[model samples]
Target: MSRPGQSSRLLICCTALIVCQFVSQLSQAGVIRDKLMERRAQQSEMEEEEAATNGPRFKLPPGTRVLEDVAYGSDAKQKMDVYLPASAGDHSAVRLPVIFMVHGGAWAIGSKTHNKVVENKVARWLPKGFIFISINYRMLPQLLAREQAEDVARALAMAQSKAAEWGGDPDQFIIMGHSAGAHLISLLSTSPDMVAQFGVHPWLGSVSLDSAAYDIPAIMATKHYGFYDKAFGTDPAYWRRSSPLHALNTAGAPFLAVCSSKRPDHPCDQADYFVKRANAIGMRASVLPQARSHGDINQQLGLENSYTQAVEDFMASLSPAIRRHLE
Candidate 1:
């Protein structure tokens, strides 16, 4: 029981185990470092990929093609592309009223140019004297959802600065987005704090959203969007701070929220919620139910989805003269 040689051997074995543990820790750290590097590289690649794609191209008035380059704000989200209409004077009837369109990608991935229904033949509306402007904004992981809302505010402000130049009336600003972008529009519509920061009055009109997220708390409560935890993390306060339903009021402007079905239990529950509350106040609100999936509701924009009629009807109802003055 007191053999000196045996004691030395046992000590050596213990030391070896410690050394092995240290080595394993080092390997794990290296793997983590490598993965982070890979992820950063992939994100860089994605930005370049988005940059390489030419934004929407159009035939400007008087047979001129003009691609406008605008420097929006401090962040890169301050960028946008303007498609001018052919031969119409600044604020002319033919110059096409501008619709500040935002794209959908769960507030993570999307480019304004990437979602051009007018470019694609799925449904044609460019000839309707409409000028479509899609803009990019900071997304989650890189920025908070609130910060992304700031980017939208900046985009609209920047548009306002050049309203006369683009023949767009400052009062006729039309805000629209899909999915998270729609959430963003709703957020901006309701959040007076965010709107006042833009240094302008509220906008004129809105057109179309498909299965957009309206209530942040309600959506997070679902806890089944596959990326909910990753997006906002598991913080309850964070969810409450970002929900649009919490901030929305009758003071918000008139807009339409569309869903796949008129029923309350549809997957796009936010649209239903918006319709219900909006109608309670006698606000000029409307909802056109569709039996399409979330993705189908959105991608259906350039296609033969039933949502087209709603968009057409809504747009047609707008006073053309008033739309022209939207900045």
Candidate 2:
């Protein structure tokens, strides 16, 4: 017979062996799972990249027309896609309002074809009787924020010149942009001189879709993320010069500043501050606070939600006839 202490030691040894085996198996399984997940993530990214390059996959509504790669300038990046709404008999007789879209990628890398978020907006609004024009601008590192704004202005001028050909009203242009694009449009709307300088017909109003840097000086003063460094850079004077808040003295078109209420320093805080400043300066401005991510604030605008309704309401305020036609 074995001694009690010896038997206890034997049992403990067996238990330890069993535990070791189980742990080894678990470790192997975890490695396999991680590898599989990584592969899946890579595949998904590849698919998204392909889709963005190819443009919107979904077919447009009947009678809607899309003019792709229309050159607004000499550079390859100075291209835009115009979507014209269908009309009854004579398309030229029906003058539609233009929604000039600007895509956002921190003002560095984005394209009219690559930003798929605007695709849904195109689908939703084109059938509703609005001519949508999604544009691309020269990016950062090579071109600063001010230059990018100038590029947008030039593109607007080009689009305005070609608006009548596509059954769009040159005078009824409404600027809409997300994030960095929002910042650019906000700059144009507040600084009437910039619009005047561009020599494009005056825009009816603008919809700023969740831009955080309305007040660049304030942003530079706070603890901002690393991206702002590349966009705004280390210059205080440039910050003020590019700032919409700093350029808000001139009363221009009405503005609907939509922002995400989630972020602490932006959209919520910055948007409200911007609107207050604009109102103080006698410019008609309104603040829209949405509980969404920065990107979602742009992507979900034309969807069937209160957010979409709010945007529609703002557009209606710009032109009641446009709203009537949609209805």
Candidate 3:
């Protein structure tokens, strides 16, 4: 028979093993949930695209059309998709305004294809001709955060140069990205000088940064950003380089900074710091009216009437020059 002390030790060991197993299972479950959300978002996107021609009932305007899967690159390796209004009767010669849509995946696992909903919604649903370009850039483990931003910058430059081919005006380039993609575009707007290192022009117009992690250093406190530990070291200087909060200065893109109320619970406080910094330096900056969660902000961009008056009103406030140029 086993001694009581031996039994007690065995019980403790078994408990430890079970606890570890439970943690591992929970981690796996979290990953599965993430993948499922991504997959569903993609599925809804394809369905919406297929249904665009039907009407507002299908959540799209009839004149709007998609120019799927175009490869916008100076080289063969880089590619992107542009969704546009089909050559409707009189608008054939007109070049529409363009928003380059960047999908978020925490700087690691997202695709241009990941944001199909936004691509279709913005491109096909807007009554005024709005062309959407979704891009895939080199991401984490392979290149990390800074490189991911570079990929977006490169894609934007290519989009600007090649806009005419897709019936979009080269002058009006809006960088709209969600979550990590929002973070990437925010960095591009605040630190256009960073992309100058890559020989790309700073964007001409507004950056719609939706649910972006503005304060990356602040975000690093979360477990997921810990995954960034290897690339962005523990040092404040290194972390600052990746944070949009640190990059807010007198220069860069005019910003339409949209944050979800449900995320960070106090985005006004969190986003205010960056918005004020940008404004104090004379960079045009404004906040979006809607108070959506991070997921809701991006998720809604794929559907109609999601933030109806709020987002549309904000877009309507842009410079008439941009509106006319896009039209």
Q: Could you say which candidate leads in lDDT?
A: 2
- State the lDDT of candidate 3 residue by residue for 1-327, as single tens digits: 999999999999999999999999999999988777655533422231222121122244556665554565454325676666555334476666777878775565555654343634564334556777777676656676766787778788778877787777777666787766777888787775767766666555554545435777875675432335644556777678878888876567667777665543355566677788888888777787456655666767644564644554455556574545333
Using all chains and alpha carbons, the TM-scores for the candidates as numbered come to 0.72, 0.81, 0.70
lDDT of 2 by residue, 240-279 (tens): 8899999888778899999888754446688888899889
The lDDT ranking, best first, is: 2, 3, 1
Which residue runs does candidate 1 get wrong by more than 4 Å? 1-52, 57-69, 90-96, 115-123, 261-265, 302-306, 320-327
Select the stronger candidate by TM-score from 1 and 2: 2
Q: Once superposed on the true structure, which residue ranges of model 2 sit more than 4 Å away at CA?
A: 1-54, 88-92
Predict model 3's lDDT versus the native: 0.63
Over the stretch 67-124, how does candidate 1's per-residue lDDT look in tens digits?
Answer: 4446687776567777655433444454345678766665677776654322432124
Candidate 2: 10-residue stretch with minimal lDDT: 42-51
* Top model number, TM-score: 2
Question: Residue 146 of model 2: what lDDT?
Answer: 74
